[model samples]
Target chain A: MKQSVYDLTQQHRSIRQFKDEPLSKETVQKLVEAGQMASTSSYVQAYSIIGVTDPDIKQALKEVSGQQHVVDNGYLFVYVIDYYRHSLINNETKGNMETSFESAEGLLVGTIDVALAAQNVALTAEDMGLGIVYLGSLRNDVERVGEILGLPEHVFPLFGMAVGVPSDDEQGSPKQRLPFEHVFHENQYNSDKTQQLEQIKQYDKEIQDYYQKRTNGKRSESWSEQIRKMMSKKTRPDILENLNVKGFMKK
Target chain B: MKQSVYDLTQQHRSIRQFKDEPLSKETVQKLVEAGQMASTSSYVQAYSIIGVTDPDIKQALKEVSGQQHVVDNGYLFVYVIDYYRHSLINNETKGNMETSFESAEGLLVGTIDVALAAQNVALTAEDMGLGIVYLGSLRNDVERVGEILGLPEHVFPLFGMAVGVPSDDEQGSPKQRLPFEHVFHENQYNSDKTQQLEQIKQYDKEIQDYYQKRTNGKRSESWSEQIRKMMSKKTRPDILENLNVKGFMKK
Candidate 1:
């Protein structure tokens, strides 16, 4: 309790590597329960946490995520946008199944609720001095990961988290962010192109300096260039079809 | 700092009623900055927060959210799934805005990022003795809100939040959740409907009891019945069309 929640949030950093340590079932259960305490949309609780403990599953998930942290961390939990349980509740009580839990509204509610719960789990783990990194790379081949995890329709795996003791005391430093004015808008959006570009340029300079110093001058790309490089690629080209077939989002 | 993050998370309750005291711009900015500290997918940081302060806009948003808290609270913020800023970077650097920033994967990343940031803000506010209530009803009329917020393409208003000093000290106790085993699965999903049904029945009974007591015999719906009642109605039926016309979730 030495650090306030605000301080822990501000000083947060992602951990890609970790030391070899095993988390007990009870310990993991405590973290997962902490997730359940989060706010849910309409109390639907449209989410699930799969604690991957089997060695085979961990190795497969590591390959799926393209991050060794998945296999090396003290614990790895996959957060899934779940409607199956709710569907079950409907089936039992109403006896009238929903034709689609795949509406855009459902997508927002389910995805947001899952994300909120996952953040709770992450913050709690961080409070315990555990290093945590979100494994969004788990979506590199989402269908494959879903199949391996036995995820049914309407239970898409959103992301994974790797939690463990830090291999080194160096979490480095908190990354720099854009200017406060540029990010937090007042009332209507400030879509003034010139003003935003001017602010982004200044923030880009800060990012460039941070990267140049942190990476020992090996990488000196500005924020704009970084965004360009990142966005140029076609990621998960079949995303719509996957979401449609997996019953994620509909009208 | 006496309370652990776990305690703070578990004690979380929706704050609908708030004191008339106004929040300083600096305090809200600090909370927003703490949001930026959360992990982003591939550094996309695909989220934008609109601080609603204009009186007209506030009144309009309060109606849109169907929650008076939006208008009476100390602060109101709408978290938008944003890639327009990223599109701007593409325009500045690559001069060729990639067409793929509107994919389902992108939507997931953006939505999750916004939710994570929002939960940080909520937790920070709660830790500081401020009340917080997420405004999911903002989506009740997505187009109207988008117009009100002057939101551009690639920025969908996912949700809003109200934060202020608690009007009353009685925050109430946390709600009960499903058994640990029902929500937290092992390496693979347990699709055993019989076992799940048994557990859910017990949970439904507990919820029925809680609601009955809280409402003084006015309401006694079990968890299953509650979810049924919620899902029976088609909410935001035009959500897909809304998102499509507003330029979101394209391949």
Candidate 2:
């Protein structure tokens, strides 16, 4: 019997190094079909998928992402929050749909739509024996990515995915997640600071142990420590301005 | 042989009515575990899931959503973008993590994390022979939802999901999506105005036919018409303000 999706999800790890074998056209089409079937908020499929096959375009994107895998993967897909189609409809009908698609709620709806579709693509590709990694680094230069992809207004490049067969050197296991009790609330949120702090402390110890073992004691960092190091300085401070330039979150 | 995730996704349809059986604790735990395994941005598991079982709380949320399924489903999950734990870490370390979590980029990252995890749960439940519908209606009253769920600062309710076994009367078929060529661009986005408008015109007809066939010719609305009607006015004008109130996008 095939393993369940739950089991499949449990085995997920970001695959950065991949074999050179490119996915077949059929596989790419199947993955896109799977993505399209995901639930859209009010049937407003406010997203698009860009399949980059041209090496020059891949090179351009790689520069923006600063990741070799962006160019080395069997297939690269950049998912964008797209309202340009809706804008077309609005123009033809002389409608006022901008009141919704330009609002902050519009941003939330579009972002959720894109992520749901991308996850479907990710899981489906994994089931097909493909490894994948998300490229949020594409946001390193949102304007440059948009220019590279020829994205129009009301279409924002949210992230990219590099998918292919994992290489022999690509050995990775699922990272530990926050304990179920820490992330799951029953009925209402438990905002008790002491309880939360205790949970974090316990989680911190577990993460530190995991890192020490993984690196044979060469590295040991708590989750909080890693988070502090990463988040202490703002990353992509220009995101709000970029969203405005892309005709999103204007309201 | 078990169905592949690709095949499973093609069969997706938002299920509203459901049988009266609640999911077992084991199943819920399994689903949550699957959700947790989804890839997070830089290990920032910036989300929390609230399982609503109390009848009063369910009713309160139902009022905010204005959806009967909120109270009638076997399970109700409210997915929140959570940075509270990180804030706790920041407080203890006196770190400057707020510079990241309060920025627009942080909003994007947290929203992506929550949706990816939620989609995993949705697919896992469907694989287990359950029905699920996303409740973006939860955003209809964000403040009211926070009050009902007792959510704190650095935590914002993005959406909800209602899950259960499908009722005998429930018969939802997968709706037609935009043409693959329209949503999936090759190499780069095809921003040619004539081509895009033509594609939308074709999709509008297909959607019209779908609704006519599904509703026995009683209702036939084009995709653009429905979008215009639903989006001509803003849905949630206060979303930006609410996000700010919850300590997001302050930058």
Candidate 3:
């Protein structure tokens, strides 16, 4: 099922249900190889992939992630924003640690690095005829996830990805996204929502239909309704606290 | 010029200097089209590309970013971590503003959204035979960049990408990064730097060679040496202050 990366990218669907089949070591290596080739921030390479092959750990990660696919998948990896390794090098050479790696810039750049590498992994996994589901829910219990992985300071877990062969459980088509014009704009940001309002109303209907079909009418809500429900209250409040405890920011 | 996205990704080298030709409007539109198809976090679509096409705005951005390619390049876009649009939609739907848009998780996820979309643009631009250089230096004056772009409270300029045809200025080989083992540890983070020190030392030699050849020996420094020099001093100290002022985090 080798295909153009763009084609695979276009065809991407998060596989929450994965087959029992396990990927070979060689295949996983290929994915990591693609990940390693991703561009890093100034070659700081401030991201690390902690592959969790241990079943007990996977089960625990699944518990915290609120996603059962994490344990059932052929492979799982916790992507972390890492500055620990670089700090060691800083210690060795400069004799004193702490630099850009301890600032807000570090968190921003490191998160970008992790995402870039994970997108590479996702795209390459799709190319290799595999399925992936990114687990942002891992942040539901960020502190325990860190304890489980023994992640040290200056290393914050950002997200998780579970990859494996597809199962029949994950049926249906790719999810609908906002139309191009709404999300993207020319030259300057036309922050005026007036232009995109009607289009989004239409998209809400499409999403409502998608949710209807996806959940067998168990949940059929418009996109905005969903947003209203989600954003009506605070989302994960502990994330920044976790990051701060991990030393991602300096006062 | 058209190649597999993976091939192009592996061959990606940020072009600091670009030819003095401007990209056509249609070409850039296609790039953005590709960008819009990138994966978003929970369909929040929390990012916006602020294109700076006006020569004056581009000049100001270039001055603040300290990257000439931004002004010289055929196309320039400052990828912003945006929740302002969502806030508008929330305002319309939920009648009030604050939601995930102003949380720590929001910042993390929005940053991922921007990078994923930007990487798609980079790859598509490469497919179109153009070169791109990401301008993290834009963070050097994050607040100023935000003010220059007229960014709203919930929108922040994360990074910039300058795209155009390749110039003869960057004639050297690609930059050297840490080898596969150093980057892609398997099943666990081999955080034991003691195990990887010798390998990184070997990699330092390779980086030294790369910098020497690229800079014509005006600078020949090892990877650790460079990391030490860079890490020895703080960079972008204003980033957190700017993010705080921009309202990205809640207590």
Candidate 4:
């Protein structure tokens, strides 16, 4: 019997290295169709998928992402929060829809819509025996991405996905997640700092052990250590300005 | 043979009414595990799931959502963008992680993380023969929701989900999405106004037909009409202020 989606999800690992087999147009269509079917907030469907096939365009995106896989994958899909279509409707009817899409709630709705659709695409591609990695690095420079993709106002490039068959060298297992008890709250949030700190300490140990075992003790960074190293300096301080340039979060 | 995730996604329709049977604790745990396995941005699992079982809490949340399913479902899950754990780590280590999580990029990362995980849970539940509907209505009163759920700083309720076995009367088909060509651009975004407006005109007709057929000719609102009606006025004007209050997007 085929494994259930839950089982499939448990096996998920971001695949960076991939075989050079490109997906067919039919497969791309199927993936997009699956993505389109994800639940949209109020049927707004405030997102679009850009299939980057032009090698030059992919190269441009790769430069923005600073990732080889952005250009090496079988397919590259950049998901954008798109309200340009709604804008068209607004213009034709002379309506005031900008009051909505220009608000912070609009940003949340668009972001949620794009992510949900992308996850569907991710899971579906995985089920089809493809490996995928998200390219948030696309946001490393939003203006350049917008220029590369020719995205219009009210359409913000949130992230990209590189999908293809995994290479033999790509053999990473799922990373350990936060314990269910720590992430799952019953009825109300347990803001008890002591309990939360205890859970994190245990998780930190597990992460350290996993890293040590994976790298023969060459690397043994705990989760907290890694997070501190990553988050100590702001990554992409220009995001707010970029969002404004893209005509998002302007309310 | 079991259905593929793509096939499963194609059949997705937001299910509101549900059977009386609640999910088992083991099942909930399995779903949460599946959610946790979704790829997070840089291993920043910046989200928490609140499983509301207490009738009073459910009723309180239902008041915020104004949705009966919030109280009537087999289970209710409120997905929050959580940076509280990271803040704790920052406090203990006296790290400058706030420079990252306080930025707009942090908001994007947290929102994307929560939505991706939520989608995993949605698909997993559907695969298990249960139904689910997202409750973006939870944002209708974020402050009230925070009070009800006892959410703390660095944690914001983004949305909720109501899950259960589908009731016999609960039968609805997936709504037609925008045209594949319209939503999926090749190489880059084609922001040509004429092309986009033409696509939207066609989609409007399809949506009109869909509603007319579904409601036995009682309703025939076009997609454009519905969007104009829903978005002409601002929704959740306080989202930005709320984000600031919750210690998000402060920079």
TM-score of 1: 0.96
Tens-place lDDT digits, model 3, residues B1-251: 33444566677778878888888978777777667767777777788787778988888888887777888888898899877767767767655546477778888989998988887787767767788888888988988887777777788888899999999876755566677777665555666877767777889898888888778999988878777777667788788778878878754
Chain B, model 1, TM-score against the native? 0.95
DockQ each candidate and list the results.
Answer: 0.69, 0.92, 0.49, 0.92
Each model's Cα RMSD: 1.6, 0.7, 2.6, 0.7
Kindly list the per-residue Cα lDDT of model 4 for residues A1-251, writing each as its tens digit: 77899999999999999999999999999999999999999999999999999999999999998999999999999999999999988899899899899989999999999999999999999999999999999999999999999999999999999999999999778999999999999999999999899999999999999999999999999999999999999999999999999888888
What ranking of all candidate models by DockQ puts the best one first?
Answer: 4, 2, 1, 3
Clashing residue pairs in candidate 1 (N, C-alpha, C atoms within 3 angstroms): A102-A250
**Over the stretch B142-236, how does candidate 1's per-residue lDDT look in tens digits?**
89999999988777888899989988754577777777788888999887878878878899889999988988989989888877778877777
Would you give me the overall lDDT of model 2?
A: 0.95
Stretches off by above 4 angstroms in model 1 are A93-100, A169-171, B93-97, B169-171
Off by over 4 Å in 3: A1-5, A94-99, A196-199, A212-219, B1-4, B93-99, B213-218
Residue pairs in clash, model 3: none
DockQ-based class of model 4: high
Per-residue error for A176 in candidate 1, Å, reads 1.6
Q: Which one is best on DockQ?
A: 4
Q: Give the better candidate number (1 or 3) by TM-score.
A: 1
lDDT of each: 0.83, 0.95, 0.78, 0.95
Each candidate: chain B TM-score: 0.95, 0.99, 0.93, 0.99
